[model samples]
Target: MRGDAETTRATGSPPALRRGACPTLAAPMQTGDGLLARLRPASGFFTAAAFLDLLDAAEAFGSGRLDITARGNLQIRGLRAESVAPLSAAVARAGIVPCEGIAVEVPPLAGLDPSEWADPRPLARKLAERIADSGLDLAPKLAVIVDGGGRLHLDGVAADIKLVAGAADPRPVWHLLVAGRPTGVSGSVDAMIEAAMSVVADIAAYGSAARARDLPAEPLPPGSSSLALREAAMSPVGRFDLGASVVLGVAPAFGQMAAHIVRPLILAAVAEGVSAVRLAPGRAILLVGPAGWNTSVLVSLAASLGFVVHAGDPALRIDACAGQAGCASGRIDTHAVASHLIAHAPALMDGSLDLHVSGCAKGCARPRVADLTLVAMSCDGRPGLSIVLGGRAGDSPVATKRLEDGPSAITALGQRVAETVEKGESAAACLQRLGPARIAAAFSAARFNGIDHAGL
Candidate 1:
C-alpha cells in the first residue's frame, strides 16, 4: 500500500499503489478483492470486437467482474501482481491504447450532438497534448471537463479545471473555471487552455497529492454563467437522435456487470452495425449507429438484457460497493441490502435523493455525501448496518441495526417516510422536516402510524 515515489525508491518493484493515485495497467491498486486496474480508451470509445476481447482478457487474468466507474472509466477487478504484465499484453494485443496523462474530458456525444455550441474534442485534444508535453507531473487524479453546451454536458462533474462553451452569436464563447471557482478568463479555446495549464502548474507547485481544492482562497469575479445542472440520474440513458447520427445509451444494473453478460449487447450492436461504443458518465454505455438507423430494436434488446435503458430506472440512484462477496474489507452484503431497499422502500426512493450502501467506512463506491448512507460494519462481532442521515459513508451513524434486521428496519423506515410526506412534497423534504431524531426513531421501528405496506 506504499507505492509513493519515496517509498518506491526505498523498496523496489513499485511497492504498492500510492494513496490517491489513479490505477493504470503499469501500476495497479491493491484492494480487498486483489489488485484492481483501470483502463480508459484514448479515443473515448471501443470497437465492439476490441471491447469484447478486453473482456476476455479480464476473465482470463482476473475475476470476470468489471466496473464502469461513475466517471465512465473501465475497471478490472481481482488482479494479481503476477498477472499485471500479461493483462497489459492482452490489452495491447486487443489494440487498446489506454489514455495517459492529464484527463481532458468531453461529452460522449462531442461532435455529434446538435445541441452543442461547438465540439470540445479538438480543444480537449490540444489541451491534453500541451499538458502531456509540459512534463508537469501533476496529480494523477487531475481532470479538465470541457462542456460545449450540449444536451449531455458535464456541468455537475467535479474537476480541477472546467471549460464551458456558450452559444455562437457569431462564434461560441468559452468560459474557464479553476477548482470549481470561475476565473474572469474567458474567450477562445486557446485562452481557456492556457488559463487551465497556468492553474495546473500552480497546483503542481504544491506537490503530487495537492489538488485544486487545496489552494488558498483567492476572490475573483464570476464568469458570465453556468449551465443549469441536473441530477446524475438524469444523465442521458436512452436513445437519442443526434441529427446526423443516432445513439442508444444503456447501463448495467448498478454499473457492475459480468464481462460475459455483454455478449448479447455486443451481438446486438454488431447486428445494428454500431460504429463505436463510448463510456458515459453515470455509468452509461453509448452505442453509436449510422444516421437514421432504427435504434429502438437495440434499445429493446438492452433493456431486455437487464440494462438500465432510461433515466427513471431505480438502479441509477443507488450506489453500492462490492461487499462481502467481492472484497475482503466488506462487513456485509451491500448489494443484497440495495435489493431489499428497492423492493421494500419504493415510497422513500422517489427519485429525490441518492442512497449509498457502503461495505465499509472507505465509501469507495460513492465518495460524496448522499441523502442516506448505510455503512455495513460489525456490531459486537455481529454484522450490522449503521444509518447515517444526510451524511457520508464514514460519518458517525445516528442509528444502527443488525444486518439480519436490516430488511424489516428499512421497510419500517420507508413506511414512516411514506406517511410523513405531504402532497407534492419530495421524500427528501419530508426527511428534513421529520429531522434526524425522527428518522432515527423510524429506523428504531418507533411508529409513524405507517403508510401502506400492502404489497411489500
Candidate 2:
C-alpha cells in the first residue's frame, strides 16, 4: 500500500483502522498505500529548519510522497506498521506535534493580517486546549473554525462551531455560531470560549454521537446583538502584500509534493529571507519574507522545483487523487488522464471550470461539487471513467466510457469538449445542451478516433 513503508514489504499489509477514526502520526490508518500518518503542525506554521526536518523524516521513514490535505494538514504516505512508532518519535524529535482533540482551524494569516478584525491564533489555541482538557467525549473529526474576519477566510470550509469576529461597534466582540448558525455573541474572547464550552458540555451530557448541530435551539446570550454574517474572500495563492512585506503563496500540483522538492523549496525560501512558512487553506504554502527579497527569483525557483507559483496556472484547476500508482482502490491513472485533459483542453483551467479526476468514488481529492468529475472505474475488467457533471465524485455518474488504446483517445475527447466551449458555450451550458446520453455517445465515439477528432 502507499503509506505503509516497509510494513508492506515485510508483512504484506498493515492492520486496518477502526471505523470513523482519522489517521494521526501516533496512530496511523492502514490504506492501499500501507500506513498513512497525518501530522497537524502546531500553530499551523513551520520554520524553514523544521519544515526541512519533516521532509527528511518523511523520506526516511515513509514513502517519499508528502501531501498537504485540503484542511491544511500534512500527510506522509507509504509506511509500515513498524515504521509508525519510529516516524512518530522522529516527528516529536523534530518538534512537530499534532493538534489533539477536536480540530480547531484558524486563518493561515491569522495574526499577521493587518486588515483582520482580531488575531484568532490565541483564541484558537485556548479553545483547543480547553476542549482537550474538558474531558468531553468529542468526535474525532468534529472541528471548529475561528474566523478573525480577515482577507484569508475560513468561511468556505465547514466546521462544527464557528467563531467569527464581530464588526467593530466601538467595542471588540465575537459572534459565536454553532455549525455556522448564529447562537450568541460575546464581548470578550473568554466569554466566547465559555459559550462554546457550554455547548460542548451539552453535547457531552447528551451522548458522544451528538454534534453541535444536534443540540436543541437555545436563546442568545443576554445583551448579545445580531449582526449580518458575511464570508470573507480567500486569495491565498500568488503574491500579496502584507504591510511593507510581501508574502508569496505556493502550491504543489494536486497538493502532492514529492520529498525531493520539499527541502529545496524551503531552503530557497529561507535564502530569500523568509521568516515564517504557513500552510493555508486550498493547500497553499505561504512564505513570509521581506519586501526587498526578489519574489520573481523565488517564484522561478519554486516553479523549477515543481511548485505552482501562479494562481492562474492550469494545474490549479485539476484535482486528482493518487490513482493506480499509489492507491489500491484506484482503477485508473488519475494524474495521467488529468494531464492529458489539461494538455488538450487548456481552457478547462481558465478559472471558470473545476475538474476533479478521482481515483475512485471515494473522491479523496475533492469531496465537493465540481463542474466536471471523472471517477475511475472498471468496465468489463478494463479501466474506464465515469463522468459526473454538475456534482461530486460520489454522485451518480452522468455518463460512462471505457478508455481507448492510448492517450490520444482521451485527448480527442477533451479537445471535443474544449471545442464546444470555444464556440461560446459555457461548460454548464454545453452539458445542458448535450445531456448525459449524447455526452456519453460523443466520448464513446471519440475513443475510436484520434486526437484530431472533434465535435462532441
Candidate 3:
C-alpha cells in the first residue's frame, strides 16, 4: 500500500480508483489498457490447481498481464469494466478468497521456514481480527508487519506498525517499530499486540490520511531494548532448504509475468511435485516441493523459461515496468533497457544499489528513489530515455537518449562506470563522487563521440 500511489498516477484510473488508491478488486483502478486489480490470497500459499484457476481468471478477464509486486501481491492488468465482477466471482469460485480489512503482512514463508524464531501467522491473524472488530476507522492503507525472525525477514518492506522478534526468552520478545523505525519498545507477545492496537487507535483518531510518520514519538515502555534492524542474509531468488523439504524461489524477469508464461511454469511445478506456489516478498515465487522430489530438472527448466533461479542473479537488482510493449503510457521499452543492463552492466550490478526503470514519470515499479533511475520520456515528438542519478522517476534527467538507443546508452553508462570505479568502491559511491554532471556526461558520451551538433 505504501507503493500503490504511483500506480494510480499513471493515468486516469476507474471511477472507484481515486488518486493514490490501491487497486483492490472491489475498486479496480483504471490504467492505459483497462482496469487493474491487486489481489492477495487469504490462504497465503496456493495449491497448484488453485493457482491454475487464478491464472485462468487473470487471462480470461484481464489482458493476460500479471505482476508479482515488490511486496509480493499479485496485480492483474487490462481488466475491462464489465469483467471486474466476473473476475472476482471466478476467484471466489476457485476458493481463492482475497484477504480483506487492514493489511497485516508477514513474511511469505512464515510457517514453513523452520529457521524462523516462531511462526507469526497466529499473532498476525489475531492482530488483523482485533483491528477489524475494533470499529476503528483506520486509514485504508494502514499495514501491520509481524516479523518473526527468519531467513527471510521483512527487511525492506514498509508498514504503519512493525513488530520484529528480538530475544526469544521462553516466549519471543517483540521490538515494536513504527514506520520502519524502531520505537525503543520491546515487550512480551501480548503486550506488543496491545501496544500495536493502541498505536492503531491513536492513528485512527487522526482520520484516514494519517501515516505512521505523521505522529510524534511515543513514550517508551519500561525496559525497552534498543530497537534493532535485521536484514535477510540471502536473496529471496534461490533455493531454501526447509529440512523436511525444499522451496525453490524463482522470479519472473522484472517482476512482471505474462499469464501465458506463468501457466507453463505452474504446470511445470505440478509436474515436479510442487504442492503449493507461494508469493514471496521481493518479487519472488516460492515453489514448495514435496519431500524427496527431484527438483534439479525443474530448476533448470525454470531458468530456461525466463525465471531467475540463482540468488546472485543481477536481474534481481533491476525493477522495470511494462513499458511501450505492455503499457499505453510508455515512451520506451523499459524491459529491453533493463535486460541489457543485467547482461551488460557488471559495474552497475555489484549489489551496490538498485536500478529502477520507469516507463513514464510515474514510477510505479518502485515507490522510493533508487541509486540510479532510467526514465522513458518524450521531448516534443521525439521519444527519449532520461538518466536520473540518485532520484525518483519524476526527477529531471541528467541526460537523454533516443528511445531506440536506450539499451546502448545504458551499456555505455556501465562501461563508463567500470572504467573509472576505484578499487573496492561501489558503483553508487563512484557515481556520488563523480557527481551528476560527470555521470550525465558519461551517459551521453557515446552519442556525441563524432556527431556534429553545429551541422543540425
Candidate 4:
C-alpha cells in the first residue's frame, strides 16, 4: 500500500484529487472564470494583445483581480457560472494556444541568454502539441520542463516529468519522477508522454493515490511510447535584457494591485519600449524593457506597482493565496489579514522572514521554500493558520515545520521572527547570515501554553 493510500484510508477520505475537472475550468465552456481554465504560457511568452485581453477578462468576467501561480501561469478571478464558453473563445481568439505542452516550462530568458546549451523553446512547443492531439486523457495539471543548458532547473518544484539535457547525448534525455523522486529515464518524448498519460489514467481509473512520486520503482512498461528527441535550433540574438522577476519574492501586501494606480504605470513602461510583461509568482510583474531604460525610472515603476522599494523593506518576503474570493475551500480571507499585517506590522517583520499564508492545507500559493509559512486549518467555528519557520530554496530545498497553532499565535510569532532577523543589521545581510535553528527558536518562543521545543 502506498503512503498516500494509507493516509487517505486513515482519514476515511476519497482518493487525493487527481482527475476531476479543475475548479477554474469545470464549466461546459471550460474557461477561466469558473476557476477551471488555467492558461499555461509556453516558456512564459504572451503577446501584448493577449495580455490586454487577459486583463480585460479578469476585470470584466471575473473578480477584478489577478494571480500569478507558483507554476508560472496567469489566473483570473471573479468568474461566474456560465462564463467559460465566452472566456475560452476570447482566449483562443487572442492567439494564446492551449496545447498539451502547457506544462513545458523553459527558463525565463531562454533566447536572451548568451551561454545556454540549447534553446528549448521550439522543442517544447513540438512536444506540447503532440501530447495535446494524442487523444490520451491526461491530468490537466500534468506538467514537464526542458532545461536548455541553463544554470537553473526545477530541483524541488513538483512536476510529473522533466526532460533535462545530457552532457554528451545529442538527443535530450527524459527523467521521470513519481512525486519529486526519480523513477526512470527515457530517450523518447512521445514515450515519456505515453508513460505520463498511463500514470494519470491509472490513478484516475483505480482511484489510486499515485503521483509522479508513487510509480513503482521498476522498469517502465516498454512499447510504442517513445519518440525521437532532437535539439532546438539556436539563434544569435543581440544583447537584450529580457526582464525576469526576482525569485522567491512575495508582494508587500496580500497580492493586491490598486487598479487605477498600477495600470498607467504598466502602460507607461510599455510606451517606453518594454517588449512584454510577465505576471510573476508572488504577485509581481516583470517588465522586459529595452536595453537603456533609466535605472531610476525602473525603480519608480516598481514602486508604482505597489511595492515599497527601499533599503530594508521587510514586507517583500510575505505572500498569500487568494483565500476567500478565489477558492471555495478557503475558510478565511487570508489576503485581507495579510494586507493588514504587511502594512501595520513592519516593525514585527524583518527582511529575512519569508511568510506564506494558504487558505487551505493544499499549500497552492506558496510552493517554494520559505523562512516562515502560515497555512490555514479549521478548528471549531473559528479558522486559524499553522506557522512554520526556517525554510530555504537552492539546489536542495528545505521546507519548514509548524511552530505555532493559530492565526493570532502565528502573527505573534512572525513579529519575533522579523525582529530577530533585524538584529542590528540590514535585511539582506541578516537573511544571508541567519540560520534555520535560530529562526526556529524565535517561532518556538511564541508557542502558547505548554508546547515544548521537541522539534527544535
> Which has the greatest TM-score?
3
TM-score against truth, every candidate: 0.91, 0.87, 0.92, 0.63
Q: Summarize candidate 3's per-residue lDDT along 146-258 as a digit string, tens digits.
A: 98878888867888899887665687788788977778877877888899998998888777778787888767766768745556446788778887878888999888888
How many steric clashes between backbone atoms does each model show? 0, 19, 2, 20
Model 2 ranges off by over 4 Å: 1-16, 184-186, 215-232, 390-392, 405-426, 429-434, 450-456
Tens-place lDDT digits, model 2, residues 291-362 = 655689888888888888877677777788887777777777777777777776664555667788888888
RMSD of 3: 4.9
All candidates in order of TM-score, best leading: 3, 1, 2, 4
Please write out the lDDT profile of model 1 over residues 285-392, one tens digit for every residue. Answer: 888888888877787888888888878878788998887777889887787788878888898788898899998998988988999998886656877788898788
lDDT of 4 at 153: 35
The global Cα lDDT (0 to 1) of model 2 is 0.75
TM-score for candidate 1, please give it: 0.91
Point out the worst 10-residue segment of candidate 2 by lDDT.
Answer: 447-456
Q: What is the lDDT of residue 92 in candidate 1?
A: 86
Model 4 alpha-carbon drift over 4 Å, by segment: 1-36, 100-102, 149-153, 166-210, 218-262, 279-284, 307-316, 324-333, 339-354, 360-456
lDDT of 1: 0.81
